[model samples]
Target: MNITALKPFKITWAVLLCTFFSALAHAQENLYIPLETQHNALVLSVSNSHDLNIAYYGKRLNSDKEYSSVLRQYNQTGDYSQVLDAAYTSAGSRNLMEPAISVIHADGNTSLSLKYISHKVEDLDENISQASIKLEDTAYGFNVSLYYKLYKKEDVIEQWSELSHNEKGPVELTKFASGNLYFRDAQYYLTQYHGDWAHEMNPETSLLTHGIKTIDSKLGTRANLFQPSVFMVAMDQPATEDEGTVLFGAMEWSGNFKIDLELDYRDNLRLIAGMNNYASSYKLEKGEIFETPKFLHLLSHNGKGEASRKLHSWAKDYKLLDGNGERLTLLNNWEATYFDFEEKKLFELLKDTKELGVDLFLLDDGWFGNKYPRNNDDAGLGDWQANKRKLPNGVSSLVKEAGENGVKFGIWIEPEMVNPESELYHEHPEWVIKQPKRKEHYFRNQLVLDLSNPKVQDFVFNVVNDLFLENPELAYIKWDCNAVIYNAYSSHLDKQSHLYIDYVKGLYNVLERIRKKYPKVPMMLCSGGGGRVDYAALEYFTEFWPSDNTDPLERIFMQWEYSYFYPAISVANHVTEWGKQPLKFRVDVAMMGKLGFDIVVGELEQKDLQFVQHAVKTYDDIKQIVWQGDLYRLSDPKNTDFASLMYVNEEKDQAVVFNYLVNNRYGQGSKRPVKLGGLDPEKRYRIQEINLYPGTSSYIDSNQVYSGDFLMKIGFNPKVGKGKESVLLKVEAVR
Candidate 1:
């Protein structure tokens, strides 16, 4: 029991800073509390001298060093903190109706995880001599700002509030070298940047690119708020220039590329969204005010795109296809290529993905606008040509009719929104991103393209390299973004430089000038969906689209939190059997990763397209052991026993287990007995049963069994398969 002797009772925050500024002189008239702690959670910094800087922390979802350093599981008989405190006390008919858990702690060495509980603050203002607290459970949030500066300075917030609604606009800013911040709303954009904008060597390849970019010349005062929202508080960045100031509360993690919402008092917004780690809860409401929405991926701008399962044809011999290497699995057509797709619905979805073997054929977004006819997200975002009334033989006759159906065609672009009734913003009204006098502010109505003026990056690089010089085969290019950047300013910099780190180095110089002119077109990085899967956009787009809520019992905790820091070969996993169960639990949770198929296979029902052709042939036979193996994390996701386990080996004689029992309680014993791990003791092992949740029968074995005689005679019930059940395992030592 040495793991910090079962931690949780460590409240040693004796800062008494004059009794926390004498209880903030009875705080209320525009407050400032600022408690703090990092490493074991506890933060609360509320400052609303007016411009808002709300901060509340302490969110749990399994603590105790994440149950002894990541699910080695310790103990907690399970029941989701009494079913999430009875679903927030049955949300007492909605909105702050007096829930409970004002605070709770977990301590150490692991086990006793209701995941997270305690983070509800709502102080509107006044009463502060000073304050700061520090409790523990780790992960924290809340920081609403209007102003603070005892002098930390990132560029003295020149006009903020991206969107807290009721009209407070100034939208126009872009910067990013790390001094992060952004603003733009006509073509949709809002900012705080930090979804893999790395630069250890020009990192950002595109996951809706952002790390900072806020520019403002003057578009001031405009906030009807629609798709624009950001409150993201936590601040610190001061270091020197005297270094002796106070006012603090910081906790930064950012990886699941931005998504955090709770609001529900006629404000209706629920999406918690995250791929892995990050999202315990931060819910801020009080006098509730949020506004930031100016065209953030509501589709249109030729729609928007990103979908991938793998598209197997060896994906162009493994570079993942496009430009003659030949390793694809493609078949996209975003929701079946929306409203009208002649050419025989793209040859009946590329002839059943070339007889279930697939090769390539994407066509998301609407295919450009012609006065907008069902172009989604409101209007006709900056038309990029090619919709002479929906393909009247253009786009090179649909890439020479999808290369005569042998497949290999792609298209979808956002080019950073611009449709305030576009014609390129009516002939470049100084390329948008306003703020000289103030007035121009529109979110799903569009306007945000000032790539730091190199003539608006050569007019969006000659309308996206003239659509690859008129369809030179097209290949693949998704590249989309939705929005963020709460009124930043930029009219070619200087007014004291820093346009949110030069709009994140002008979005890595527009993806390094489109990889020096499409060095073989292959981009993907979409936002709005998967919010921008990160890792500095995987050094320039190879894959990512990890979430749009894939739902396979909720993608087993979103692919176990995107495999704790990406690399299931960059992920693209599709197989979306349109929610609410079945389709083999959405192709066994999209065959774990890197696969693809978003439906429409001759309109399913041939036994759900033969269970998606055996879940894409068991995702092409264990996709090289789930892309180069080695993961091990087994069970305990704040477990109320929706049981879970994970394995994928390669060394110690190849393993491949993946148990999950979910929804237990019938005699509370669905048959236990599971230990098994690393093999090859005295050799002799064959066993080849792939999936056995509820048992279908396919067991074989050489059976030598060593390693503590198979960890005391292997057994596995696991639970949570409420949709019947499943247990998939596969071994193969053989020495």
Candidate 2:
């Protein structure tokens, strides 16, 4: 029973069996662990062509493991109660087909069905083939066994120098995320599920399988089930070049979604399962290994047609404005104002922002204070009142001046934290998050506002409500939080009951009240940058600050990762120079999302401003297309040499192409121009050049011959600028 030889087999099983086992493991109504070991060993066997066999060696791990069942009885509601059914719950007749855990004890061999759940996975590799075998080893300790079976025969390509591995470390098994398996063969790398439950399927069931957990977000407390998950691999067959895929859990718990890859190996390579985990006790049997090359062309790319159509559908149905009736392209004065600005400086920034075509102007933190400075997080966090010295005429005056500038005024607030020197902290020390009779160790010299209490929620909401009442012109709020709760405690909650959920609910209630009162002011979510960026937060705030790091190259991958489930319109990509560490990819990558300038641009040269102006104009032209059109990823993050392309088309005849030139450390620089597809075949597109980066332009084709399948093919260079660079091309159909 040596598990060491099983490493390669486990890798194969993880890719192929992840969807299969996850579905069945969570298929039962009780959400109970059937194994006797807290950590169980996972095994996968191909019973007979179509039927997959999955086995969990050690299911029940602890004496208190059965207590999880009691918790389920307490939490049971709606569809979750259906899992207890004796028969398998069918997915019914739909384009998506997913089968749950089919348990059979015949000859002591268990067989289950691999279920394909998400539209994203289906859309990503719709044209590619997939097969996997996943094994979870909980027998000795927690570990996973995976065996990847490549179904796609075409030239299979995978990258070796992936992002996380680039940094020097112990090669953490689950460094990218937790409760997941990370493996790399010559052709592909794999990441399995561990603790992340928000992206799991049938969350209630996933939660019951794994222990129930809580997550804090702008929406308050959400009970999420973090499950160990898996994905499938396939050779891409889209309009663009194909890359290997590692599909996993996203949004819902039961889907076969994948993060697309760009293959760079010159040699025609195919991925085979390998035993890379030697440190763990799991033993690998070389003879037990299996190899198969099958192409997954069915789930490949359908182009921008379906994606754009979906975006348009979401936009037409979703409201862009706040309940208070204010439209937003908000301008916050954090960079322009900071703590050094006076009322006069605020006016200057507001006036300039108004002229720059911004709809809402927000005064970032540092506006409120008394003797203690509001310039930093150390002072006046919960002191929500105006500083008479700094704001002599009060916020009403500032709001009036902003109104006169033709822009609605907004303010920043962090209701969850309180400075020790602040009046609120002095008045009630019990309000901070702390254990009873224990000294409260502070972060940033501040304590977290305990949202578990209704009193705290009301008090926090009242502060913002008072500010809004005093200044009716205030139309937006930039809600900010510096950190997550390090020590979880709530005075109002029971000692035995988990207080995290209560804290989340209280936070949610406060926002609900604020939205009810000042429905007109849209709150832009900002949490120490993007620590709070998730689907839960997006449900409340109209937009989110994508990250604290706004460097374009970094943002391209970040935005790409986020775009898998979130809408592009909800992500705010501001143009901030931070410290002009120049990279060629800056402007183009920043414009891919909701566009705004975060840096102090008042001092740039006329040419630079002209570049900014042109970017803004181009943004306005393609805003709808980027926000509502379907997006197709063309480059691989693993291979920096390959270019990244995001194509948005409003009409079949019109398309906008965003090209990024990534720097490759090895080999000759990318020379091949990418060939594009999914365009109007009959109409000749008069390619209008809108160059954002420096590059020589030449049309590969002159005479517009009968535009048919050929229209699906257009080429662009893989590399353009030195180091990191990107290009923007908008193709228009000319009659």
Expressed as tens digits, the lDDT of each residue in 1-735 for candidate 2 is 879889989987675455444443343322222211112212222222212222221122355344333222222222221222211111221102122111122122233222211111111243232222232211112122222212122212111111111111111221111111111122332222222221222111121111112221221212121221212332222122333232222221111112212221221111211111111111112222221111111112232223333332332233233311223565566666567778877777787676567676777888887866587778888888777777888889988998788878888888888888888888887787776767767755767888878889989898888987787767777787764454556667654133444565577688778877776557777765554543334446777765667766566665765554356677777766653434224666766777766555577666666666566667777777676665666655545564555554657666666766455345434466555555656766644445453334533232333342454565544344544345566666666
lDDT of 1 by residue, 1-735 (tens): 575753433322333333344334322332333322211111222222121112222222244332112111212222111221111111112224222112111121111111222233332233111121211122212112221111111111111111111112221111101111111111212122222211111101111222222211111111101211122221122111112111111111112122333323222122221111111122223233321111111101110000011111112222232312222456677766665565556667777776556557777776676765426655566777766666667677767766886777776777766766656766777666766677776654665776666777766667678888887778877776655443555677554234433344456577668777775566776654554443334346766665556656656665654453344555666776565665665666565656677578887767666656665666667666666554444453334344344344546566665655444456332345555543445544454546433324433333534443453256333333444444455666665
Q: How much lDDT does each candidate structure score?
A: 0.42, 0.47
Off by over 4 Å in 1: 1-330, 333-345, 348-382, 387-390, 393-411, 417-426, 432-448, 451-489, 492-498, 501-531, 534-561, 565-571, 574-590, 593-612, 616-688, 691-735
Task: Name the top TM-score candidate.
Answer: 2
TM-score of each: 0.31, 0.60
TM-score, model 1 to reference? 0.31
List candidate 2 segments past 4 Å from native: 1-248, 251-327, 579-585, 664-670, 691-708
At residue 21, candidate 2 shows an lDDT of 45
RMSD (Å) of each candidate, 1 decimal: 21.5, 16.4
In angstroms, the error of model 1 at 618 is 7.4
RMSD of 2: 16.4
